[model samples]
Target chain A: MGVQDAEPLDVERIREDFPILDREVGEGTDLVYLDNGATSQTPESVVETMSEYYRTYNANVHRGIHRLSQEASIAYEDAHDRVAEFIGASGGREEVAFTKNTTESMNVVAYAWGLSELGPGDEVVLTQMEHHAALVTWQQIAKKTGAEVKFIRVTDDGYLDLDHARELITDDTEMVSVVHVSNTLGTVNPVSELADLAHDHDALFFVDGAQAVPNRPVDVEAIDADFYAFSGHKMCGPTGVGVLYGKRHLLEEMDPYLFGGMMIKKVTFEESKWNDLPWKFEAGTPPIAEGIGLHAAVDYLESIGMDRIQRHEERIVEYAYDRLTDHDDVTVFGPPGDDRVGLVSFDLDGVHPHDVSQILDEHGVAVRAGDHCTQPLHDVLGVSATTRASFYLYNTREEVDALVEAVDAARELFAV
Target chain B: MVGSDMYRQQILDHYRNPRNHGELEDPTFSHVGENPMCGDEITMDVELAEDGETIERVAFRGEGCAISQAAASMLSERLPGKTLSELREMDRDDVLDMLGVDISPMRIKCAVLAEKVAQDGAEIYLGEKDLDRTSTE
Candidate 1:
């Protein structure tokens, strides 16, 4: 599949931005890092932006009146605005809340919103394909509040069963929380349609956009989501930073997930009045450098254009799908190659994914093996585990070829 | 890459053709262990001797990578005829030696899941045996 592209963005130029692309592993085999879904490699731009912040204006934001504090505060607050715009968030700056990671973002909503709104006999809806972050958060909230959880079934080819989803999201449903993209299955869900469905039933909708935000364009307004959550590390930003975009009304009604310094306006010995919209949620000292780095990451993605990156990944995924299917023993999961995101999760005929990955390691080909923190999704797919190879802007067709070659080598080593 | 190393031919052989691979009918003791990180699970069952001092039989059922399954199969073969005390003294290094492969720190979970399950079951079996004896007397 040497199909030519329309060339909105030069992928070769994009690959040049990632310094890790030229790395060597093991005994000098060229590195083929395919674990972007776990964490994408950072570019020089993100590195420089964060480093410049530390060297130039390193101070606590929104606290000090010094020139350094003013500049740092501007950069940090600007990051929240950039991130909001990145997702096409209509609620804008007042909607964004920075947290530790996507997991923390989900916890904030579950603890702050779900715990307060949901009650006994109220239903929380979730798809079987949800990552542990979103699924476990809702489960615990349901348990604490005596609420019930309903699951939407997955179709045979790994798409969400809308018929089942319709049945599950009934009038009793208080919230509909699902992953926008399946991290292990590579299925890009219809977030807008699901959001519409959730709204029709008078239920709040939350999209775990952890995997989707890195691969495709996500317009929160268009989707009509009440809340959307994603992480920075998965999108080539530094760790310890994530975003939770909730509607202003919801944020105002809910209690803060964390309570401490910086989240309060008036501090008394007995009682404390909380801060406004975003500040009410961001407790303690926030990750200033990480917030600035995330802004740089958003800028990097915008420079390439999300649609172009999507198209680029589509070609690479199609090629990888074709290459993987060439093997008689391989079984790729999720929908067909055309329907998935930039990743492919699959298993060999007899080889376990961990063994396959270990053999791939010997070839300097990196892949994620195991349950992928979505064990229930793997259980739905009737597999204990799988090996996943994911792509990003820096990945190439040649890198996919290396992945196939390494997989072939693994098959040979494990062949009976 | 697997040339006579950790992923040896013998390990693959044991993995493909596991011995005593199913459960015993209402065994005296049974325990399931899982490597939560990798989702590898092993359920070990043991039939205690009439005297309750020894394991009369052992069987395991599991699904995982070659190392974990192979280790389970190999451990099952050696479990029968071992005293409860002997089973309790089993160590991680002993299982590694039995597998005849050098496992990495990352995969220590894979190679040791079976032993972990078995030893845990053995401990419970020994404790229950004492409790039964005391209550009966």
Candidate 2:
């Protein structure tokens, strides 16, 4: 396939917003960071956002009766409104809860919702491509509740096999948790279809949006998922901050995931009534600065528009696919189409992924090489590990060129 | 070029033709250790001499990076006559010395993965030898 021009993203102008982009690495080579699947470098606006919060309204939220507390509280709560709207959660701010990261968000639902609901003979269905955050939580919940765990096999072409999903989400299935996009394979699952199947079986559907939220648009209501979880850091926000969007009814019905200072309504010696919707789930001191930074991050993403970012990434992916596949020594993994996210998992013919990654790193290009937390998927793919190059809004076509050149160099280096 | 120095000729040679790499038939001890984070697996099999302390033969079978596979190959050449006690005394620095190159901290696990498997196999060998002694005694 002939490579087309990348979508117009004003990447140079956007790059200016991220200060780290200009930093030099490895004997003054520009950092060609392709590790977006792990975390994204925050723009200056997001940095200033959290700094301004600490410099100005540094106070605990919802408890103190002071001006600083109120200002911080409003900013923190507005993060929820922004995230809810960003994900198209029709329930709005009331449905969004903050946690440390996507792992914590999934655990909240598993412990509070799954533990309370699931029991013996119940099955929790999961896709084989789920990251450990999405997979292990359900496993823990299953162990605790004596609920059996079931899996929807990944298709040979690198998709959540919808046919297998239909068979797995039986009447006894209590929940179906799957990643919105396979972090390793870049395959975007048909989550709305899977959610529908879960609904048919009267099972709850949770989408792990850690890899999806930052890359593409997500609509929790449109997808009809009972819960959606994503990390702030992966979306140009700060670490120690994540958002979990649940159906308002589910949030109201489920027991509290954490219990302490902020989440209490009326706590006597013997009994305690939980606080309203989200605050009940967030106990202790919340990630005040991180949440505010996430709001700024949302604003930054909005200014660029997620649609444009996604298109830009898709164009980059197309060009990368062309460039990498043109090489005789490389074989790309995942579904054979443009339906994937802005990432590629591939391996050189004779180079182990770690060695390939080392060669890439030596050339001042960064990529992830390992099982990528989808061990089962890797096992199914007949590879112990794969080298993955994941892109985001800030990554440019030049970086992809750097990656391809380095990979080719790796092949040559190992040729002997 | 130094850019490709990490995959030195020695590393490449060992990876291309790993020494003593196969399953040992009816081995006295064997264990498969994995650096799960990097997806490197090294299964070490050892055939003990009648003395039950010397490794009469040592072989490895698994898949990993140049550092790991090459290190395993290097260890196979180094371990044939070493007694279980001497093998047990081998440590991270010794393995790094055997590789004869500077190993970055990040890739140290890859460089030492074979050593971990070999030591684990020897540990199990000791356990089995003691059990046999107890059963016979």
What DockQ would you assign to candidate 2?
A: 0.55
lDDT of 1 by residue, A149-230 (tens): 8889888898999999998998999999999999988888998999999999999999999999997778898888999999
* TM-score (C-alpha) between model 1 and the true structure: 0.91
TM-score of each: 0.91, 0.92
Tell me the spans in candidate 2 whose CA falls farther than 4 Å from its real position: A1-7, B23-30, B46-57, B80-83, B128-137
The local distance difference test score of model 2 is 0.87
Tell me the whole-model lDDT of each prediction, alpha carbons only: 0.87, 0.87
Off by over 4 Å in 1: A1-9, B1-4, B19-32, B43-61, B76-87, B128-137
User: What TM-scores result for chain A when each predicted structure is judged separately against the true chain A?
Assistant: 0.97, 0.97
Interface RMSD of 2: 1.9
Which pairs of residues collide in model 1?
none
* Candidate 2: clashing pairs of residues: none
